[model samples]
Target: MNNITKEITPLTQNDCFTIFSRVKKEFNFPLHFHEEYELNLILNAKGAKRIVGDNVEEIEDMELVLVGPNLSHVWLTHNCKSEEIREVTIQWHKDFLDEKMLKRNQLSFIRRMFDRSTKGILFPRETAQLVYKRLLVIDQMQGFDSVLELMSILHQLSTAKSMRVLSDATFNNDQVLNYHSRRIDKAFEYMNANFHKPVALKDLAKLVNMTEVSFSRFIKRRTGTTFIDSLNEIRLGHATRMLIETTHSIAEVSFNCGFNNISNFNRFFKKKKNCTPKEFRENFSGTRVFI
Candidate 1:
């Protein structure tokens, strides 16, 4: 798997957010996370793999996504053969919209949108196309006009009807709770450490000092997913990273991700990702290895 690392993206002194529009021949960034919120737009890069926290998928000709602070993400030039790849990236501090600012009635939707973005959010094609056009001209504005345009862009995104949340439940557990529940925190800590093994629901229930039924209901209420589904999501998260970063065979990857049988692994992967493991791996170009 690629060595997931933290990156520090530099920002300018006077700007609340920094924006960049670049035309590059290749996407060579490693799998990394940063402290700032990011809105990225990519054009003319089809069949590229987009890795956001525990989620992995292929992008089409144009893609737009909002990634929250410290969420690992990267776009690799998988099958794209474009001579010039157009990309626009906007980065802002996590506190750019403070709690007080978000509490305002007018910003309620944007606040909720930002919260959901703790697990990366992908805008649909129509919204993407609309924002893509706006982004193309944003660099031309200056001072207050620039800030206004950016706010307009965010408002448009906040109202979009069909955005997809990319990462799985495990990836958002910590962010969603914000250390509010110690028991849930401990449960996640244990799960992260032992997900590669056959973790029993009874064992987990006991660890949290509850019966199996009560524990199941508690977890479902907290995470909006069943215990088994959450465990599989954690395993699949690791499996996807392995598939992208390692040369291991599907069987080996499955076993390493705690699946004892290949058939069961294949079934679970297809159900979650809508594609077979082999096809997912093949979506990326053979030449690009981001480690």
Candidate 2:
């Protein structure tokens, strides 16, 4: 696998498409938004507020949320601190399912659910568990079976009793579109371009036309994370993508993610994922080293 870069971009693009999704995480990062529809189901985890689109609430176990294309959302996994590991995630392209079939008599309810997701949608615990069981099978299957399984999951979500649309922000929420609300799009763009290197707070502050102190407060409020937190999030994100999509040694993946040495990388990886890089790769491929 190619070395991953640590630089955080205003927007992360994978071959022209914005990357969206997470598999399992020991803990998630602060608030970040991207250009993709997002559906998340986290089981047996507790956390503080997750600002899905514009709606905010305290998060609890068996939580489920669906956000539309370009909508802003955050899941606060930091609040939960336990030795036990328990989490799951399932996200896909907005058009993963056929569009015309969305409204083809049988799926109108599901289509309506998609429309409602433009704001954001949440499922009650009972409803989430029912769909969660189906979703586990969906993630494990491939080809036509996967498609059918996903449809089944959607159908279940659409009919949940305590279902709710979360965000009240417009489809054109500036906050979602490059932090336009804070007028920091340029700063964000530059950050992504040069995150791999040391970026002084003063330099980033100037880029956004603010003093360091003001910029610090502004960013933390905007994204619910400090600057360093955001930077590490980018590094880990790149590492995770490479782990899932490519074949590379753990040492190589660590360097690609901007770790200066193996020891630090191992610690960070284990902290964030509750597993080492080698274990991550092994779990995904179902392969183990006998040695």
Candidate 3:
């Protein structure tokens, strides 16, 4: 959790990685990552973005980006002129294919594709358009033919020249794997429990009995973000859920999420999400609830 892989295992042992996803709304999720190789083709999107390991950017359609396992990222909508609809996102596990294909065979070029993933991958416009078209065709196929088409896609991805990695730090080491994880875990637990409502930095620092500055640095070193940022993440996380699944008004959501006024909530949401509250809600529903 906290965007890191605890262990490195053989590729063949891992499965259950989803190969594709489709969404019909503007996405409202936080910066979280899983232990899989994700190849996403965003057919439609308009938002602000945060790619934790390397960048914080603005993302729009049609985007083709590849996210490596455990790389923390988020693309929040600050404002949507209309509804947000995403077409296809293809995410494959690092071990989804064969071991020999990745470890020993240059015939597959899978390892090279993974190397490119270190920086995150973004396919150029025309290429993504082509990939999406082919993916649509493959979606209608079944059985072995489906697998063959997917493998063909991966093979093309392996040889693709229109790719770029999205982050700076390739290694996302799990805190649980660290010697100091117990302390880190306790601190994180406490932060999660009380991030909303008024959170005092000094009090949070004292929970682990450290000075504010020292604690802040300690947290940043462990999670690639400061303790305050972690707290805000909690609040923002809740806000995202409400925006997507509930019918709360923006001011109400703001107050419930621990922010004071409409302006502050707007500012914070925009900074973190890259889109206004109304836009986020519209991405999911036309329900006119508060953002």
The lDDT for every candidate, in the order shown, is 0.78, 0.62, 0.62
Model 1 lDDT, full chain set = 0.78
lDDT of 3 by residue, 152-247 (tens): 776777777756666767646454222245656677667556655678878767887889988778878876767666666667766766676567
Residue range 1-291, candidate 2, lDDT tens digits? 011111222224322122232345455444544445556766656664577655777677668787776566666656765444344444555556558778688888888888888888888888877776665545455555665666677787887787887877644344332343544556555565665566667888887788999989888777656776666666776777677667888887877767667898788777666668788667663211100
- Sort by TM-score, best first: what order? 1, 2, 3
Q: Which one wins on lDDT?
A: 1
Residue-wise C-alpha lDDT for candidate 1, range 1-291, written one tens digit per residue: 236644434342234877767787688767877667899999989888899989989889988999988788899988889888888888877767788999999998899889889899999999998788888777777777878888889989999999989988424323233324677767766776786798999988999999999999888877666888767776776787678769999999999988889999899887666567898787644321111
Of candidates 3 and 2, the better by TM-score? 2
**What's the TM for model 2?**
0.54
- Model 3 regions lying over 4 Å from their true place: 1-20, 47-52, 104-108, 171-173, 176-291
Error of 1 at 289 (Å): 30
Off-target runs (Cα >4 Å) in candidate 2 are 1-26, 171-243, 249-291
Each model's TM-score?
0.58, 0.54, 0.52
RMSD of each: 12.4, 10.5, 10.5
Determine which window of 10 residues in candidate 2 has minimal summed lDDT.
1-10
